[model samples]
Target: MVLDSLGKSLRGVLQKIARGSTVDEALLAEVVRDIQRALLQADVNVQLSLDLTKRVRTRATTEKPPAGASLRDFLIRIIYEEIRGILGKERPFDLKPKRILLAGLFGQGKTTTAGKLARYFQKKGVRVGLVAADVHRPAAVDQLEQLALKVGCEFYSNRAERRAEVIVQEALAHFPAHLAVIVDTAGRSGIDPDLIAELKRVRAVLQPDETLLVLDAAMGQTAGRSAQAFHEAVGLTGVILTKMDGSAKGGGALSAVSASGAPILFLGTGEHIDEFERFEPTRFVSRLLGMGDIQTLLERFDELSDKESAEKAAQNLMSGRFTLRDMRSQLASLGEMGPMSKLMSLFPGIGAAKVDQKTLDATQQRLRRFRSIMDSMTGEELDNPHVIKADRVHRIARGSGQKPQEVRGLLKHYESTKKAAHGLVSNRRLRRQLEKQFGNAEAPAD
Candidate 1:
């Protein structure tokens, strides 16, 4: 939910378009004004926002909708294109056997992003290695070593070496054959001559394939200046915006960095090492405007579970045979997809729903507790919840360290969820809509 306020404001404008009987000049003007206001409030550069809205307005009024497309849909497309243009083209980071040097100011999350990048490539079937070149930070080497162990990747650093260049050389020598090395460089409090000099030395020695500048999303309009400085010093291949999940100025940072002509390569979505993702401008803007990103959602599902398993789970839900075990598996899948708010944002219309994070967290916690309680149940009770009578519920409660009423609540939830799933499966219109939205890929047979 980066730039949450901006998303809300743009969604409101789209709602106005949806409500209007026709797309008229007045409506277009209103939409432009609203978008401009939203972008400015998100701390975007004023001139950039104005230019973008102008393009949107011109396209909406002059261009004709596609034969089957509605006027509202055409208008939305124009806005989407204009916003996507401002965000620049997507620059995908390919995980290969090459050295990647990370650079940025202090507290911009460069060290953490280095860890995340290593984990990302490791997940992509690469033998990844991390070289902690941040000799200035007291515990930076230790932090990268711990993250390497956590992700089961190779780690290289030299505490005795005072020069980062020497550390880089030593780390490269020790790296396993064909391993992709990510060098975590030190950052200064500000972009200073000393910092740039140190980075230049490291860069010359490492000869990295990619030099990425990590900028804090909360840096707002200043992100452009920082990116420009790094680009000048190290010839940056791309930029990585960090702390994107919590930054209100995320919009500004993204737009500003894009304006600097360095395509955003990735985003630090959360604190978890696995939360980083490759940046795709079109998909990102689509989700930002509440158009849904099915590809990303599907990728999440694929990461957490195999295709056959997911298809089987879907079949179970459709057939109304969802058991407590199935429910627990679903809960675990949801947990792996990060926060509910973020997952919901990837779904069209659902992002507009006013869901409180506290409520979402509480619901997730309840699901985990339910799973724990189910673990305490007998196998037959999980498969056939109706077999769990009052006495059995009491036993489960005692085993799970909860009251009997709580155990009963879990059973009630299962029943309700099953009923809802049956209702959805029975709705042909809903099925057709999903097929149309997500394409007609058939699920595995029940």
Candidate 2:
């Protein structure tokens, strides 16, 4: 859902290609123009946008598709490749035992990103230690210390020391056993000599393995200049673009930073510590083009729920044994998946761009209301909805502080879901197929 508007525009352009009778020069030109408009609207660098479309145009016109491929598919591939070219190729971020230093200007979410990085590495099975090297900010040390405690990582700071270099030196010795030590450095309002000198001193003491610039996605064209300046001041190995979920100009920042010769190692999708993600150009463009990133979706599920519980939930739904409790658990899992818009973007042909924001908002609200209503239900009513008579419904409505009609709506939904699940359970062939899939057995033949 990052750059949701741009995704809608791009998907609209692709829809044009799909609906066209034939792929020709005129049609290709129109598609290219639409792409340019979308990029420009998303605040992409003008020259970069032009160059990308040029490449798209050249490839679509000159290149021939393979024998089995359709012209439309080939053209789409060209556009995907060109767009990805501007974003750079994917490279693996090293996760070995090393120290990472975060640097950037003020108000780029550096401290928050430090927490995210700590969570990231901790999840990767690395013993992480957070170093508070930002001595200038009044609460920077406290902030990093709290983040360290929240992330369950070792924390190190010398509050009395004014020089950041000294703190880095002490932290390095304090957490030597930690596989990944993340040093949160100070930032200035703008790139200045004092800031650069301070970074140099910290780097001298830290001698980090990776120096990452915590760039803000809203920086747009200025993101490139900032990255270049930082790289000039102190060599930058990679960049982490923060606030990606909320930035309409995220495309601009991503393209600009990639153009500046710094590989984007990660993305801060949201404010939560777990919302950070590694940046992969192919998967990102795939999702942007409404092709869904199945790999990431699977990873998300794996991270949130174990296989046993997931299989049990799936089996319950398939067997028409779903209860209000099961429904509530499923709803909670859905909420854990982040915003509905971002979650929808993970599905092919159903990206957030295809659905209006108002509709999504309404759906989310309904889900919350349903959950609240269910919370007011007793265990007996939750396990067996048939016992929930009109009187029980009124009681639940009053308990949940919702209207009687809303309680009836939840009941209606439950009945609809129960009916649908029964239909699936009654289908012998489909049930067999599902069992085969879930049991890891050989596929059931037609």
Candidate 3:
């Protein structure tokens, strides 16, 4: 949901186009104007925004729609291409075991990114190690060590050594074989002379496979200048934009960095280490245009729940045997996928529907509360909710620190869900459709 305001504006433009009786020059002009306004308000460079909209206009007017495509589809395709162009090509990271050096300005999340990057590769089945070479910051080494422990990665550091180069050499010497070493370098408030000198020293010794510059998404237009400075200093292989989930200036930072010639390799979506993801320009633009990102969604689901578990859950629901325990597991899986608003944004038409943020937030809160209530329930209560009478409801509410009405509401939801699930389980036509969709044998009717 980064650059949410801009997404809303772009969605509005598309809606207006879809509603138009005809596609004409005037309509194209209005669409272009709306796009320009949205990009500008998102803090995009004026020239970049103008150039993008101009290209969109030319293509929409001159090029004919594909044989089977409508004018609206063609116009939408043009806009998608233009936006993708500004975002630049996707630079995929090689998860192979290799040394990576992280560089950035102070408070740009370089230390945290080092941890996240390690976790990303670890999840990909790579043996990763963290080397803390940030000797200047008092807590840098400790923070990296804590993160390494939290992610279950090897940690290497030296509190006694004042020289970063010496510390890095020692850490590398002690680094475990077959594990990828991620070296964390010191950063300053700005690109100061001392910081540059120290980074150069570390780079010379480490000779890392990838030198990644971490940039803050909220830096806006200044991101380009910062990127250029780091590129000139250490010859960056790629950039990682951090704090993307909460930044309104994410679009500007992304465009500016892409324009500077260093492709964005990953986006730090949230504070959690698992929130990191490799940047994909095409899929990203699709999601921004209100088209679903099925690839990413499937990847997230795969990460949260294995194939066997998913199949088991589906079978249980289809058999009308779902319990409070099953519902809690499902909720946990969804929570791992990140915010509901973000997940919904990946659904086609949902983004354009302009769902209120408050509503999404409330739904997420309610689901969490329901999980909490379930946690307080006894095994027998989870197995058979019908056994819970008025007295049980009061006890459960007190145990969960929730109102009695809230407890009743959860039971109501469970009943409704159970009824719908039974209906689906019994419908022959629906079972056939599901079988076709999943390419699996149909289960016997419950």
lDDT of 1 by residue, 26-88 (tens): 888889999999999988999999999999887777777644456776676567667767888
* lDDT assessment of candidate 2: 0.82
What ranges in model 3 sit over 4 Å off? 293-446
Task: Write down the lDDT of every candidate, Cα atoms only.
Answer: 0.81, 0.82, 0.81
lDDT of 2 by residue, 160-229 (tens): 9898889888877877675688899898999999999999888888888899999889888789899999
Q: If scored against the real structure, what TM-score would every candidate get?
A: 0.66, 0.66, 0.66
Inter-residue clash pairs, candidate 3: none
Clashing pairs in 1: none
What clash count goes with each model?
0, 0, 0
TM-score of 2: 0.66
Deviation from native of the Cα of residue 109 in model 3, angstroms: 0.4
For candidate 3, write residues 336-399 as lDDT tens digits.
7777878876554454566798998899889988988999999999888889999999999999
Give the Cα-based TM-score of candidate 1 against the true structure.
0.66
RMSD of 1: 13.9
